[model samples]
Target: MKTIALLVVLTVVAADIEFYKTANDNYDIKALIANATELQAFLDCFQDRAPCSELTASYKKNIPEAVVQACKKCNPSQKHMFRQFLEGVKKVVPKEYNEFRQKFDPENKYFDALEKELSKF
Candidate 1:
């Protein structure tokens, strides 16, 4: 019982240990934007849309935060758009449930690197 309790305590503490590179609450995001831009470019290319640049910029500006009142209202493209948005938080965020998303296949490696890089925002 003591061991289990200790393990639980450690797990909780570990989750709170913000690695220096990945700390957002302690670090400023504006400084991270340069790194964030690279991932955005790659995604913009993958999505192969001209407006991807503008959409990404709007997302960076937090326009969606005002627009997306509910989770379900988030559409497929919006999720796609968000995967691009979370580039700064990728390292901290867990992988998604989608089997197709769980591993790198086709553009998966690229997208994984892309997501990993994106989460730096």
Candidate 2:
């Protein structure tokens, strides 16, 4: 019985660690994508062209690791929202998207694999 209880606890802990903390999950990604001004702000923030909001800063901090890991820590909604945001950026502002790619993926290492994996989500 003690062994079973320990196994259960470990399983729960492992599950919790499998994804990133969800605090920012409720942020309105769709709205940000739809509003050109807001979208530009996010791009500017990430590209170091402007100051970042607390939330944007937090996201910028995690973005590289998230991309390298193929968003393994993202929950389903986050995965979907990220895909939506990427598609929106690439479609709406190709130049800025290229700039973003250059900034974040300077060596051209991660984005292709990340996008391929994200497409599966």
Candidate that would win on TM-score: 2
Instruction: Give TM-scores for every candidate, taking all chains together and pairing residue i with residue i.
Output: 0.23, 0.79
For 1-121, candidate 1 gives per-residue lDDT tens digits of: 9999999999997677432111122323334434655544533433443344543454433322322322223333444444543443354322321322333233333444444433333
Q: Candidate 2's C-alpha lDDT? A: 0.82
TM-score of decoy 1: 0.23
Worst 10 residues of 1 by lDDT: 19-28
Question: lDDT for every model?
Answer: 0.40, 0.82
Candidate 1: the clashing residue pairs are 87-118, 87-119, 87-120, 88-118, 88-119, 88-120, 88-121, 89-119, 90-119
What value does the lDDT take at residue 100 in candidate 1?
21
Task: Give lDDT for model 1.
Answer: 0.40
